[model samples]
Target: MDELEAIKVTFFQECEELLADLEGGLLAMQDGNDDGDTVNAVFRAVHSIKGGAGAFGLEPLVRFAHVFETLLDAVRSNEVPATPDLVVTLLRASDVLADHVSSARGLGDVDEAVSASMAAELKACTDPNAAPAPAAAPVEAAAPVVEASVAVPAAEALIGADDALDDDDLGFDFQPMTITIDEQAADVAAAAGNVWTVSIRPKSDLYRKANETALLLRELARLGPIEATLDASAIPPLELLDAEAAYATWTVRLETDEDENAIREVFEFVDGDCDLEITRGEAVATDDALAALLAGSAPAPAPT
Candidate 1:
């Protein structure tokens, strides 16, 4: 094998070790041994795999690992408490992550539906409003829209489960309405631009995890044109500065057609490691918010 091929093989071998660490750390958390060290270990395992996968251009593995690692990051930062149900979800996510790694290594194909479901579950743990990422199961057009309360118990009692029926089998006609209002608005937004003001202030933990603000800015640029300003006044003097500590904040005015969720997704992996505020229409003074964060004071009110 060539040198590059050998390096790829070595990365997958290391992935095995990382996956083991991920599983072990999660199991420990499930058993109520969830201390700082255990959470950090779990975060590191997913983070390391994500970094290596990006280098080799394994997009599927990288995407799944990114979602998985985001939840772990939230748990590590204590933004999302590590509860029993969440721990169970994390365990299932780890299994899907392993399947991604195996598929990347050409060992087998992962069920796309299952992987999407796991990614959605992980994301939901972080943002409860996030809908499931998997495509909805197709429903037969001819089936009657029976009352959910009555149909569920009736189906359970009669056939033990509900199955799709043909129009002849159902002996009823069903009409469906097509709603286009949301779809039309989305299309209009795609044609017209929306402006968003985003402010980011990174804490020391953001740098500690090897995340870079520059890369985030670059990713934001992919959505649209952005004007970014850096505030370095918070930095202490050179002699007092710590290399691992982050002191810079950024204000970005972005003009894009993307929705708020797209903008938020850019910072998902850094969830609690930084202070981020996204505003549309009138922008808030994020500098005041940053100051409040540093001083442990209430944030300044938004202008009317």
Candidate 2:
């Protein structure tokens, strides 16, 4: 096999390790050892899988993992109490996440309805007022990939005010945020004719629901060279921070020959959760243009 195929194999192998770590960590939490480290470990496992899946353009895997990771973040931040019910729901989510990974690798398939139902249950855990998820239908034989057009109900609507927390008082520092961009490669891609400029601003509810900013950025990188900059201007100081709100936006300059539809497809599942705009443009000047783009208020129009 070529190097690309070999790398894919290694990723799956590593996923097995991550899944194991995820299960063990969840089990520890279930056993009443809900320490910070355990929560972080569980979060990292899902984050790592989402990162790798985004790199490989595994959209379905990334989408579900984002939801799973978001829920874990709420628990880790203590916004959602780590009750037995939440732990049980998270454990089940972990199982579904593993199934998604397996399906991505062509080793197995998962019922879309079941995954959606479980995702709803996980979302409900973050809301004190939301009704409990209805009983899940009995598992049926694995079906074909869920139709991309079918709308999964938005989970953000389930978040309640009680789920929001003051970050300063919580005494928990968030993991430092970073964006990975291959500048040298992007430079070369920019010189080609296929470059595009993409801007994304996710609603505060997006992060509240546990959607991942980093994973989405990584997913865009899968299409071609990407130079991303996080717009932190809107972020309030720690003393004023709302732990559950999304304050940062991203401006990514993507260099790819793929048409607008292809780039838009990267965010298909998150359509309503974010404000996205794509436009054809000259190669991005990494230094000046990236800064200006991130600071600007309006994006250019899409290529006709």
Candidate 3:
């Protein structure tokens, strides 16, 4: 696709992911669940947005992303530890970035004061010598990137409110049906039932090492038997690499009677992390998994 097409696709995909990532970061920070994956996830989203904006010659976006990327890099590489204070700062930054994304689409300019506050907060979080963040930037030398990570006691970490969620809360309603897949799809497909195909394309530079396509396919298995055909037509040579972004798209055919809501739950945590479509196929007989799923209590055993 051309730049315009790519831009449209990226904005739609990026917005979902950015918010999901922000949610994860907040949850991790609040729960004291400082896993590398959570931090890396947030960083990768910011990094990809910055790279794309740079390619499109969007200076205002590029500028904000540059500073934001630096902060995320620090978090990802463990330069600065994940602190409650930093998490709050990042959340505020997320709002600013959201505005930037909107402004890119001709929404309006982000408030100058909001932008200024973000700039000041970012500097304080990244710099040790800087006095507490004021309403303006300081006239000090740039902070050098530290080599080692900071270790903090778990008890000292800041916490967030625990938001409870269950499968039902997540829109997982198991409605079973049967759909047929093409005979030629046997190689990619593991089983045959109600077939549903999904197409996924991840933002470039999403994964640090392996592309998310393969990783993404593995995760799909949790929902049902999914057949994924790699579209390597756009695949570039390893030498010309944007290893972070995944250009390869997959046509995944899943065999199950799972309803759209049930199937959609598979990609919930990854909202905005991918492009997707789900379509039905030929029908067949199936059990009432939905009845069982929707039933609050189990049926009583037959009298023996």
TM-score of each: 0.53, 0.50, 0.41
Best by TM-score: 1
The worst-scoring run of ten residues by lDDT in candidate 2 lies at: 147-156
**List of clashing residue pairs for candidate 2:** 70-210
List per-prediction Cα lDDT, in the order shown: 0.77, 0.73, 0.60
Root mean square deviation (Cα) for candidate 3: 23.5
List the candidate 1 regions with Cα displacement exceeding 4 Å: 1-10, 24-43, 51-88, 99-113, 123-131, 134-193, 280-304
Worst 10 residues of 3 by lDDT: 146-155
Please name the candidate that would achieve the greatest lDDT relative to the true structure: 1
lDDT of 2: 0.73
**Count of residue pairs whose backbone atoms collide, per candidate:** 0, 1, 9
lDDT of 3: 0.60
Per-residue alpha-carbon lDDT of model 2 for 109-223, expressed as tens digits? 7877788788677666765574454565676553232221211122122222344656553665433322334555544555666778788899875554445666576667767
Clashing pairs in 1: none
Q: Alpha-carbon error at 163 in model 3, in Å?
A: 73
Error of 2 at 172 (Å): 47
Q: Please, what are the lDDT tens digits per residue for candidate 3 over residues 187-257?
A: 23324446677777765534431123443455456555554666777878889866555777767666565
Error of 3 at 58 (Å): 1.5
Ranking by lDDT: 1, 2, 3
